[model samples]
Target: MKYRFVIILLSILILSSCEFSQKRYKPDWDKWKNYKWILNKNVRNNINSGFTLYKKNANFNLIRYNENNQLVIWEFKHHNYVSIDSINFFENIDLSNFILYPGQTFNKEDILETSVRINSDLDIDLHLNLNSDSKIYEYINKDKVKGIIGKVSQMSLSDETGYHQVLFDFPIRSYNVATLFFKRDDSFFILILFPDDGLVKDKLKDLNLPELNE
Candidate 1:
């Protein structure tokens, strides 16, 4: 009977150790610092989908719900290369040019109808503008380009609710220049569009975001 009790206690210790190790392996964002919240009328009007931008080191990150209604995040790094130029470039561009047909898969030709380029050397210009390292230039240059169709979906976060026009993919270079427009009541906003580069996959796992309802 004593040997049976000892075996059960050993099993309990093994399970507890496994659980502790799993928890320890998880990434913790709360420990990270230097993230600052910033407001940009342009971002508010165009790309953020009415959400605020978070600047971390030199990278800019935004979080929002995608067409699938899943929480997705977009990140733009190496900002010193593109920030001002991107802002000025997008200011003159009209978003009305790009509209997605519902229930259809969009292509590069469909995107061209809206005046946004799938790939532009102008993006490469950001790297040149900053006189970035060759490796950095190559990284941006080699990033694959893809299109994200713009569509509006109603979403609520905390107490605020609005209809957000989801658009484009990121690294900012891929979409050339795109925008996300949001309307909440009588107010309208725009943000400079970038491609959805999926840089937030691991970060999202770290955040432990709750499963959202459709």
Candidate 2:
């Protein structure tokens, strides 16, 4: 009788928690996905303005207009990095040759090499396992991959001097990923998933995996 009562209480608690979470986030997923944003005034004025990207099965489209007002859409396959630009120009140099493992210690050269193409040659530092733990990987449930870590800069293209700010997150390693674009001060900023150490890197070729659409 005691064990049965405990199970009933636990079941009620789990159901209540689920109900609370759903009410808290009352998310309109469809509206968030398909809403055509008008973008800000600064974004409209740039030469790269009127650009839009829509993701498809296994690829994405980079859509823009030519001088004639005709649409030019370039479809690029979503694949892993072939070289340094795939990561960041700065992080690319050393990464091309070096093989990184989980829980490994990073050195001075690692810092220097990773900061090369970021923020106009500005140097970046890494703090292992304390402030920003590189060894600990986060699994972002939405994208179904290991979490990301590193500093991302969003800059304006019209005025080279204008930029928004830098965001830092960790372990530069997984697979399932998503990249979102935002325009600030007439510059474009992209939020991309950085791989964490896991089965993702090992099984990247399994391209037909399901997305979190449900």
Candidate 2 local lDDT, residue 167: 21
Q: What is the lDDT of candidate 1?
A: 0.26
The residue pairs found clashing in candidate 2 are 90-117, 149-169, 149-170, 156-187, 173-195, 173-196, 174-195, 174-196
- Expressed as tens digits, the lDDT of each residue in 1-214 for candidate 1 is 9999999999999987665443221223432222212222322222223222232321123333332112223333332333222221111222333333321111224221111122211232221111011011111111212112222121111101111122332211332222222222232222333234424222222222121100
Candidate 2 Cα errors over 4 Å, as ranges: 1-28, 31-88, 91-168, 171-197, 206-214
Cα TM-score of candidate 1: 0.19
Write candidate 2's Cα lDDT for 1-214 as tens digits.
9999999999999987665443221212232222122222332233232333222211111212122111112122332221112222122111222222211111123211111111221112211111221222332233322223333221111112222112222233222333222222322223333232323333222222233221
What global local distance difference test value does model 2 have? 0.25
CA error at residue 6 for candidate 2, angstroms:
63
Question: Which residue ranges in model 1 land beyond 4 Å of their true spot?
Answer: 1-28, 31-36, 39-60, 64-79, 86-122, 126-214
Worst window of 10 by summed lDDT in candidate 2: 121-130
